[model samples]
Target: MNQTTAGVADDLDPDIRRFQREMAAAYGRYPDFDRLPLTERRRIAEEVRAPWAAGGPVMHSTETLNVGPFGVRIRIHRPDARQVLPALIYVHGGGWTLFSLDTHDRLMREYAARAGVAVVGIDYSLSPEAKFPRALDEIVSVVRWLRSEGAAHGLDPQRIAIGGDSAGGNLSVAANLALLRDGDAPLSAILVNYGAFDRESVYPSYERYDGPEYNLTTAEMAVFWANYLRGAQDFSDPLASPMRAEVAGLPPTFFAVAACDVLADENRAMADRLRAAGVPVMLREYAGATHSFLEAVSISPLADRAFAEASTWLAAQISANNDNDSQ
Candidate 1:
């Protein structure tokens, strides 16, 4: 509520400005996301949903895809035109425990429409029930299936891109590496949003932005890590924690970070590493925002802008890659 902070908040569009204020008033103290009771957690999530569901962009699409090990169900958002389009494989965030395609339908729809591509939202198996490697396996299977069957769905295998928020973001990166290591068809690009990359909280952003309605926190992240990693040995596995893996020769990447998220530094570090490895990387950090802002599509312009940047970057990369291939 100081002069400088207030000034920055004022810069947001009116709806986002109000949302920022309301979010602060309600949970400004940074309560641990994992500490809240199930009922309370659902309540807060619903509260966040009201605004967007009321007046937000409507994404049109065909049937949902039910393709995975154990019959995992995923939703697909397709654009209107008939010509085959590039595919954007999307994953939703819930610390690998809570969320599903339903929780993030709107966000995926918006991404598909604005980015002008087909978006496949994967409902990867959750934790405590299925555990690690299960979700990862499911996502990889679906992507491979998409590559094999994408033509039937009017999707171009050459323009395949993976994207997701938070835990989903983590999966997106892991999926990219999984495909590359296994020698599966290469993805053209990746869109990682506030991904849970590093397990350790050594990054300054973890300490600096570790508070209140800003969304992600160190304590909450620990809970996610615990649920994700049933044992300490799992952390060392490259498939489980991508930041610990070798990222060389991966596809082009687009990373978006909320300045207020505790994971910001790790994301930045990942970007630096990817760039050093000679991969084309686009990293955009939105100021005065917190984690999950993109899900708040109705209110946060930062979310909209971040999506815009990702879409633009993807278009350019895909086009350039195509141009080069035809040479």
Candidate 2:
């Protein structure tokens, strides 16, 4: 906390402030995002990717699966295959245009080990290159793939969950709706980590946190949304913005939020919508954390506690499958 950015305070959560300063010092400042080429931007993000505890099993397998014209890479983190286990099909978030499987590998591994459920991370195509329905279609495709072929990988397709952070969180909601529309079985649960549910960004959190202090700004968010969409018309598409979707019939959900994030209010509103729709929802907002703070799994206690709470919740949901299996 000794180092202070212009708008940030010296006494803010000492851990969060320290994490923010270190991340800025490593990756270029949040505002520099628009200046860098998208490719190089992703590269630098990879360079400073958080080093989450490598406490998982030694052996892990990752491979690319060409489904249709798109070749999506999926990495599986499983501890054992002696018994068919519940699976979590996860999507990583980078504003829909940044990071990849490698960026989220350690975080996925940590969950797989800690929760004792097999974790499957999907490496879907990015946007600006593939806009609108493309990424959403790809995520739906993987969820469909998991439902049909997961048993071969020792995963119980009948009992599965989907989870993600940020843009990936938005995709998780969209994918759940897409699957439900196709009349597929409901997902056991879904975990949304600090997701941007609304396209409008009209939430007060967006305005309040719209500064250098929080590490996410309205300017950078504009770029991400611009890159993800086909145009302004796409904002009306529920698949593009889950906050606009008919949220009824959604499975049980867990939303993890940062108190000081532009996306915070939208997530809160989403929980309200889900509850009003009779969908069970759990919302956890950690104090003093910022967007993408979970990436600080290796650094901040807030992230550690958030991760533990999320994993424990999902683990309980996955274990509930046993009662159904018995019946």
Candidate 3:
């Protein structure tokens, strides 16, 4: 709580401060993941870290569709009218095992309503249930399904984007790579918010922030990947860890990183790789923030502001692409 660095000092956004305190109280009992058994940790994630639905935009309706091998449940957030708006496929972050569409309901609704686009939240199969490649496969299939049937939902098929936070961000990048690798439908843009893009080696942040109540930690990350990979030693595979992928010609991207999150370095590294590959990219690092900030809409004003910034960036890209094509 460095007042000078964070600005506002004691005048911290009331909502944000309250949310942080609530989170601290919630996880106070279970401070260290290492102490808890795997089952207990999972239980805490599901039962304790559940996100509160916030007030902002209203969703017209929720439609569930089973389109993947595991009967993947996808939630669609439709806008008020039946206009052909751009659509963003959102994936929630929980280290690929905990959070789902239910935890991110408010964030998705805000994205759809504020971005003025249809949002499809993908409930991809989780680890120890479907594992790494399985979840990746489900996400890829959902994107393909959208490309085939998006027009029916008043969505412009060509204006589809894919994005998510943390593990979901990893999947967003993986799904796009799968599309390109298989010569399937290509996404127009990719949005990765504080994505955990590297798992093979722990970065500097991991060493610096491995404590509890900070939201995500380096030690917790090791546990996540242990469950996520399950001894499948292909961490360097570009699809699983997009940081290692050849970014030479991937789609345009928007990367949002939190200042204090352990995953901050890897997300920034991925952004640099994308830029090196000549891809059009917008990279933003929010100061004085932690991982998974975007989903905790009730607690983080920075999260809401971050989402709005992402929407603006996405709109600009869509508009820019549209203009380029018309020329």
Candidate 4:
């Protein structure tokens, strides 16, 4: 099959298609990757992603620290020498089963540099081992910690946002909802990049883009959901599926939707729901983009554009928050 029709639509951006091919080539090396043990699968995944995570803009300083009772490890990337900086608490996506702070290092650095804010990537407990609420709780704890003690590390506690891609995106919203429920202070913003919001209902985009050509398949998502949930009962929990939650009072949200992704329609629905709830929303859909396309920054100009756009929005949100605080 040609690049256009290999695993996605004919309109798939050529650069993104090349990214898919590169990813496929990486996975091709491990023909039995799916059959491997989770530990082995993760090892291979990290190795596969190492090159993509390399050679990004160097940080002014990077620090790794363990926080909370569960000892969640977080990597903080400061873009400049500023003593205090706004922060984006980033969660890395791997179906809640794979990927980590290291695998997503470059993406975090890119955001930190581009947005001129600190980017904090957390090493939340993974699924099947930690399960739902565990990762969500860790994220919530990190945010709380930043609120209480972040100033010691040069973070502006009042100007904090949380974001992630795929599974991480799901956790970002879940954590925000949890904080809201507990009557904790609200976040400044939420950034979601093609988040998997609902696991119970399969949307139209799922069927439309239900092939490996798009980089994410229905079967793979099923496995991911299975790994993250304790049982079928968890499906209805808003924390498990923020799409089913009461989204009122959420802070401003920016959605980076990928047109060819299975999560596209749901992302649109989410943006609509957030708007209906009276939440400020900025929804941008990238034509011909697929899930996880942001990682293609090294090879795709589209990915660079996406990052730049998100960074600009993020910077503006933080700036707006700062201005309000000053006023």
Candidate 5:
């Protein structure tokens, strides 16, 4: 491990340490997703992450919506069917090439049931296959589709929020920006979780967690970007890197940062930029958390607390948005 990572290793949460060992054992080594064949890498990742994805079958109903070209697979997790409710367009994070609706099903269900809003989990096409703006394009299409046809799915189009974790958080913000840029109505709010916002950013956490000690390495991040972007040209595109995008018109936002994550500083910078631009932003840093800790919500108390905080905050923002519209 690097010296900076070693220094911070002792301060990591006990559960995080246990998770790293557990994950290492399952994968036979730390995952180098960029080096492995796509199918093999996905299989190992899914198997290794399976244990932490624990949750009983969700009580809320679920259904799939097929949007063409983008083939944006919309998996809606509804809290109930008694009335129309606010909804969130949830994008899952796997560096834009891993994970699916099933991987994030429980997390989405927990948020849906807890927040009393429908969660539309997006299973968009992955990168190297779809590339940078393709996924972002699908996000835009999905958000717009949600706005136009949400009522048919028991969702209140005017009360929809957008959110995602890791790369998904990047897309969530980017999609909202795209919508506003296109002169569409604004989304209710945004939920970002440990997102990778800047493809070209260099932060302290990158060095501190540059090796396998923290489960995610800067080298792996580099691979992820290369695979997700068309080429070097895409790096500076504000849609691909939201930190460089205009932020003045963003909706109220709540994003979480893992104290030990490489992306922590980048996420912080995004929050700071948003707040500086007069956008309402709430940034939460969990003391002992690591990247993708939310995936362990079933097994980690820290993860659970993070989810609860996000859930409460999301419900409030969506509720406030609804109240404002009524007024």
Candidate 6:
């Protein structure tokens, strides 16, 4: 059954449909969005997403710092004035090209407030200009810095987790892999939300949810990959496409899969692979959700439910990690 031909929009969860409509209307203002240059496109995208990032659970304190040789900027959102706290190092999803810490401000704050941990959002270098491994290197460096120097910022080095959505998800896992290769897997947890795991392979979900109705299309993914990769060979590089990498010995992982997303199948496959590798895996599929659905937390109860569930799971993972560290 080719659901695309049947108009998949008709099958969208009502709240999700509303989100799509609102987002579409916002992007509709820029009729020449696709034809614009990368700089212009990104500027417009920031403007479009400003409304959604407007309001959320305010943090007890927020600080920005430039760390590492590359001066990677990270925004730390602490939920309360704790002398020491566990942290979730969050990477924002923008296909490795768009979005930033500012665009995902609310999302980070929500996690910090709900999960009772500091949310550290890294402003990694974006694609086409930065290329593969550049962002990955910066992320790994930031993790190391947090471990060695984070106490000054009130972060517990041994109780840190890393996570992100879409391309950010891909980097979160790749960073851990980089650490493992260096004989260090210090992260307590990994959170993947509809991540782009495999770049070289096409899955069944692409056919069913690749249309514009889903907010993420196959064509757009192709462009994002091209922008992020330096050459064709990079597609098979495990760090660039984690589905091709070794998954065993990683820490506990939580996957927030969107049932209607083009990346849904890959998220599931990654979860299964992790479980097979004997890693503690928590896979939760959000029914009737689409790509980038979590950004609708301001309006959609489905998005709210998904966040609440992920936060609960994240809190437990960090808490358990804390208890183990005490032992």
Q: Is candidate 2 or candidate 4 better by lDDT?
A: 4
Write model 2 residue lDDT over 1-327, tens digit each, in one string: 011245565434678887787766665445566477878777777777644323434434444555533556787777554467788888998888888888887778767766777888888889899998888888788777788888887788887888999998999899989887898766888989988778787888888777666877777788889989999789798888888889998988999988888888999999999999988888999988888788777767888899899988888788634555211
Instruction: Give one digit per residue, the lDDT tens place, for model 3 in 158-232.
Output: 788889988889999888888878977458888898898888555777665444434576666776787687465
* Count of steric clashes across candidates, in order: 1, 0, 0, 1, 0, 0
TM-score of 1: 0.86
lDDT of 2 at 14: 72
Across 1-327, the per-residue lDDT of candidate 4 in tens digits comes to 011225445768999988888887888887777778989988988888888889889999999999977788999999999999999999999899999998899899999999999999999999889888899989898998999999999999999999999998999988889998999867889989999999854689988887778888778888899999999779899999999999998888899999998889999999999999998899999998988899889988898999999999889888534585211
Q: What is the lDDT of residue 193 in candidate 3?
A: 87
- How far residue 120's Cα lies from its native spot in candidate 2, in Å, is 0.9
What is the per-residue lDDT of model 1 for residues 148-175, given as tens digits with 9 covering 90 to 100? Answer: 8888888887778888989998999999
lDDT of 5: 0.80
Provide the lDDT at 261 for model 3: 71
Candidate 4 collision pairs: 7-213
Q: Which stretches of candidate 2 lie above 4 Å from their native place?
A: 1-7, 29-33, 50-69, 324-327
> Residue-wise lDDT of candidate 5 within 1-327, one digit each (tens)?
111222336767888766655665666564464467888777777766666666743656888989745668898888776578888889988888887887788788888988888999888889879898888898888887887788888888888888888889999999888887899766888999999889874798898766565767787788788889998888888989999999888898998998888888999999999999998898889987888878766667888889889988888877634576211
lDDT of 1: 0.74
Q: TM-score of each candidate?
A: 0.86, 0.91, 0.87, 0.96, 0.92, 0.96
RMSD to true structure for each model, in Å = 4.3, 3.2, 4.3, 2.5, 3.0, 2.9
| Candidate lDDT (C-alpha), each | 0.74, 0.79, 0.74, 0.88, 0.80, 0.88
Clashes counted in candidate 3 amount to 0
